[model samples]
Structures are given as structure tokens and as C-alpha cells.
Target: MRGGEAATLEAVLQSVEDPEIPVVSVVELGIVRGLDAGQVTITPTYTGCPATAVIEANIREALDQAGFEDIQIKTVLSPAWSTDDITDAGRQKLKAYGIAPPPKGAKAASLCNKSVAECPHCGSINTREISRFGSTPCKALWQCNSCHEPFDRFKCH
Candidate 1:
């Protein structure tokens, strides 16, 4: 790879949207952790994420289409993935997509804790978790008492 090739690859990867959340690119979701010469590193939101294979496949397709077939993808589970890995812009995009972004800095120990989740639609803090699991495994179903609207809350971990 020549100078700036890796950066170009990173930018290309930025165009690959998450399979579940199309509004946010995988890059914005913090899945593309590193971009080095001839390689891109990624960490799925969860280990058993059903979309993991899809995400990788999408990335592979994108790379091929972008003339980056020479680039390889590396999946890493160490250091783990966290809601905190989500970029600030990603959080904003999630809210705009009608899903409550998780509170930052949350860990597994606080999984049962009911932190106030602002309703994405009406921006109301008055919300309740209807179910620990939402439309997907990585989110929780929540309803806003004020807006009477149901939305998904991206689970933190």
C-alpha cells in the first residue's frame, strides 16, 4: 500500500452501514476499530451477534466494490465492544433513527439498572423499559410515558 492508502480504506469502510441500523455506518458504530496497511479490524457489538457474519460480508463486498479487494478484515473480540465505543455522532444518529442511545460508560454489572432513557421521539426522560430485549438482541424495548410512543433503547455493556 502506498502513502494514505490505509486512510482511504478507512474512509471506504466508513461507507459500509451496519446491517441492523442502516442509519449509522459500521464506522460510526465503533465496529471498525483499526485500519492498518492491508487490513481492517472490527469488533461486533456482541459476540453472538447474528449480524456478525452479515457485517463482515457487507464489508467484504464494499471493499471489493471500492477496489480494495487487497485489503483484509480482522475480527477481534479482545478489549470487547462497548456502548461507550459508539461515537457521539452515532448516538445522535441513533436518536434520530428513533432508538434511544444507551447511557455512556455502562458495564455488565449495571445491566439490570434502569437508567433514565430519553425518549428519542419526544426527547422526554420519562420512559420505562417494557422488555429487556427489543427488536434485536442488542436493544431493549422502551416506551415513553409522556409521548406514549414505543421505541428501542440500544443496550449498554
Candidate 2:
């Protein structure tokens, strides 16, 4: 492909948003692991994620629009995905969008009693979880005591 064409694909990838979390782009979320030869390989943030199909569709649409007709989309599961891989900009975007981003390695250690569920609304640790399932499959439902508002917490992977 020509130089401009490759740039077009990059631009298109930046536009593909995570279907489940509307605020973060799949690229910034570190899901698009690599791009080469009209092919884009991605690993889902979470396995069996409900938004996998939509995310793939978005990637395909973006590539096609960028003139990549022979696009190949692959999903890699080994090595898994972690919240730590998410870009700092993506995390900031999530916060500004009113959704709390997963803390660094907090979700993994959360199972050991080191809960990192801080209230996004109040920035206070005084919060309670209402449900594991939030508006999206990737987030948990939580309520803040300080703000008295319910919000979604991005689960650590």
C-alpha cells in the first residue's frame, strides 16, 4: 500500500469505538494489537465479551472505508488482555466521560480483598457495588455514598 493509504487505515482504526464502552476507542484500549498488510489482529479485552461482534464489524467497516478490501481480522487469546495495557489518554477519556477506568492491577488483586472500587462521582472509597453487570458487559454497577449517584466501573481484566 502507498504511504497515504496506510495513514488512511490508521485514521480509520482511530474511529473504531468499543461497542460496549462508547467512550474508549479500541485502538486506545490496546485491543488492536497490530496492523499489517491490510490485516488487523486484535485481542478482546475480555473473552466471550458481548461486544466482540460489534467491535469486529466496526474494524471491518473502518478498513473497508479506508480502501483495504482484503482486510483480515484475527483474535488472539493467549497472553490475554489487561487493563494496564490501556493508554493513559484512554483512561483519562473514560474518567471524563463519567465512567471510572480500571485501576492498575487492582482488579486482579481485588479478589484477594484489596478492593479498588473507588467512587467515580466522589473520588471516595466509600462506595458499594449494586451489581456486577453494568450498562455494558465490561463494567460493574456501583453506587457512591458521597454523590448518591450510580455509575459504571470498568472491570479489570
Choose the strongest candidate by lDDT: 1
Query: Per-residue lDDT tens digits of candidate 1, residues 51-101?
Result: 999999999999999898888899999888888889999999999999988
| Estimated TM-score for each candidate | 0.94, 0.86
Summarize candidate 2's per-residue lDDT along 2-29 as a digit string, tens digits: 8887777778898989886778899889
In model 2, the runs with Cα more than 4 Å from the true position are 1-4, 107-114
Residue 22 of model 1 has an lDDT of 98
> Worst lDDT window (10 residues) for model 1?
105-114
Residue-pair clashes per prediction, in order, are 0, 0
